[model samples]
Target: MGKTPLHLAVTGPSSVVASWILEKDLGLIRIEDVLGRTPLHYCASAANFDLLLKQGASVNHVDKRGMAALHGVCYLGASDLVACLLKWKPRLDLRDKTYGTPLHCGVISGSIDVVMALVEKGAPLNAADANGNTAVHVAAKLGRHNILRLLIQQGADISLQNTNGRDPEAIALDAAGNVGILSILKHKRQDSPESQSILNIVDEDTKASSLDNQVTGNDSPDFLWDEDSMGAAEQNELMGLSQSANDDLYTYEEQQEYCSTTFPKPAPESQSNNGFGKAAFCLPR
Candidate 1:
């Protein structure tokens, strides 16, 4: 308990070292480093993560640093680790001492995959840290237009001022010359729950109508049967899919693509397509 054996083992070249320590004491999985990081906190490999979880590691355990293994995994930029942790259904919007949520911590790590994972999990896109830094603030400060765009499309509040009173647009505009990022951040609003509810209802209606079309095998004007539209029930099923155990954006993207008939499609391209290039992405925050 004097040191984080799991963290050591995970960072060490020998997986067997971790295996041996864990075998000696399964409780070691819960042991924290001086900084309060657990073995789960140090895991960079999915195999180690799976093994620890199977052995009773708690995904929600926070380290002395005020972050849980879930946030730590996101910070590690391991898509596999992020995928594995979300299946455990860790609490969303849980803040550290600094009030940083997993969404905040994840965005700092440069893993858009992890960011997408949190977004799909319905993590509050508008939630801010003690410093009033929303995920958008962090992304914009770092010039991560892709993450910024994703957060924006998912209804993140870009207009919210941080502790310094700068909105996301101001942060990005001052830090970089990317006017496109500014243009994207400038467009936002308070999404009404009524609209979301209407979306749900419309999805249900689409399903019913699509089912009729399916039975008739007749092309219906109500929806496109191709890459765009699906039955309402199936669409609803996809909307609730964030909690599913299956990993990655495949299901989320599939849902977005299939439900385009109801929700307008937002551009999902990375900044590279806009001439900014991935090479310019800010280093992990």
Candidate 2:
């Protein structure tokens, strides 16, 4: 025989060799045959963690990707294996050699269950990789609507922009073709009135700045608003719209009062000393 039935079991062949090994002898294979997989990887990939784990397989061993059994279980959507992995206290923050975390995998798979599992297990929903991409950005780019909702609900940074100067919403709107995803992205705003007020201010400034640039023959206005600023403004507007649409949205009570008051509020503390009508517009936050 070229290889023993137990060896075939390790190879993941469908030769019923695992059963033969179990029948041939108990504990016949040393723990080392469990290999980098710890049997959990094979079981998870095969959807049979229960039996494999019952036979004393480890749950935290890193595979070739530096992912533990829990990581594998996440992609497999193995609920039981996940529970078992949680019981074992597998490192929730375990990152692959490439710095990819379980949350990254969850977002890519579009599996909300895996997302919730990792989140409940203390996985950082806002954790960014070397590329500064959060789970929200991943979900949005992939158009994972439900996953995006779960992430936003958990307070993922809706405003965090990537190096490419695009926030989650911008990416989602560009890549997301699903109406459901767009609908979810439509509602992750943090401040409506404040954002709207800022945009109105920006628009007025833009027009004035345009005229100033034209008259002065200056190609660049004072701190000309770049694409990044425009995207930030747009993000703020979306957040504002989202908050206004949902009654359950939370806004600062002070801002609410100011927005509702008939009288014009005083200039921001930063602009109080400035000349009349010079309300700190264009000042960097």
Q: Name the best candidate (by lDDT).
A: 1
**Candidate 2 versus the native: TM-score?**
0.52
Across 1-285, the per-residue lDDT of candidate 2 in tens digits comes to 112223223323232334434554545332332233343444422423444555665555675546665655565455665776676666777665433576876676567877888888789877765445677877776778788878888877777765454566555555524445545655445345345432232234564343233323323211111242246454332111122423212222332343336234433652333332211111111
Clashing pairs in 2: 189-239, 192-240
Candidate 1, 1-285: lDDT as tens digits? 334434544542234445645665677677775556666765656666777788898888876646676766665566787888888888877777542788876787778989999889889888877666788877876677788878877877776776555566555645544455655554443255434322232235554343233223333221121123456455323211123334223433443343345334324442223332221111111
Lowest summed lDDT across 10 adjacent residues in model 1 is found at 276-285
Instruction: Give the CA lDDT, 0 to 100, for residue 128 in model 1.
Output: 79
RMSD of candidate 2 to the truth, in angstroms, is: 27.4
Give the Å shift of residue 46 in candidate 1: 1.1
In model 1, pairs of residues that clash are 36-64, 207-232
* Residue 108, candidate 2: alpha-carbon lDDT: 65
Q: Taking the candidates one at a time, how many backbone clashes does each contain? A: 2, 2
